[model samples]
Target: MQIRVSIFLKEKIQNPNGHFVLQTSGPVPYGFEVPGLIRYFNAKGQEVRRTRFPSGGNYTSALRQGSFDLSGDRVTILGTNMYNTPSSQEMDPSTTSNSTRKQKQADTTPNPLATEELNLLAKLMGGMEVQKILNVDAGFKVNLLALEQEEEGM
Candidate 1:
């Protein structure tokens, strides 16, 4: 069955102005290679990003993390040991340094996940977590529930 996942940008974490929301459609199998996830900005045009599972890389340790970059717009998505960790933070443009720039280049390199981060992420992926589910209808109810169940199993 086909599925659609709503990737809501937190209110405080808006994408570059004029960019549309990222509503991913299709069955994203576990360890799926999310390629060229694009977001458009009025000022810069289009930006591209890669979203892939990082479970086998440095993230194999305690947590998993993934990375992505929206170069032209200066936006990056970094996560813990897991590719799509529960918590995310944006780099402040006001602060620039060698290490910071290096990290930006790395884009979505999985970062070491702390104990708390891992646990929180797990909970979020689990039913114990609460999220604002968007864009649901009778057709997708079953698929979404299955998706949630599948995610919790992970």
Candidate 2:
């Protein structure tokens, strides 16, 4: 079964191990299981990574403790919602309770990368030439634009 979920990174905490702790938020469809598996995709819809929340627990809190090595900033997470109605009493109440509480807490935390920063990072990582153009002080904007036009012409 296909389940549509809107996943957004709530906060990113830098860990001592150089990996990041990503706190994400999204609505799990009614009857969806908690601590479910989430597969992250890039903008191209390519599956980049996958993670599972600890069993028998709320994912919002568990996600805070999970570590990930994400190279890009934008991601789309996909997961299946097994049921249309809640059958497990434990899953219903805890999911709602934890989501509500975490929502508030996540809002107060700052996002690791702003939109513009993310865009720049994506561009810099596009290719070695893009990185070189961004680093050079001489007409970098014009050079980047020209490179884009060249790519489109190909």
Candidate No. with top lDDT: 2
Q: Which 10-residue window in model 1 sums to the lowest lDDT?
A: 58-67
Total backbone clashes of candidate 1, pairs 3 or more residues apart or in separate chains:
11
| Candidate 2 residue spans exceeding 4 A from truth | 1-12, 22-33, 36-56, 60-141, 145-152
**What TM-score, computed on C-alpha atoms, does each candidate reach?**
0.18, 0.20
Give the per-residue lDDT of model 1 (tens digit) for 60-89: 111122223443223222232232442333
Whole-model lDDT, candidate 2? 0.43
RMSD for each of the candidates: 19.7, 17.7
Summarize candidate 2's per-residue lDDT along 8-124 as a digit string, tens digits: 122223444445555445543344556567989999999999897655533443223211323111112222223333245423433435455355446556455554465566557
In terms of TM-score, which candidate is strongest? Answer: 2
Model 1 ranges off by over 4 Å? 1-5, 9-89, 106-154
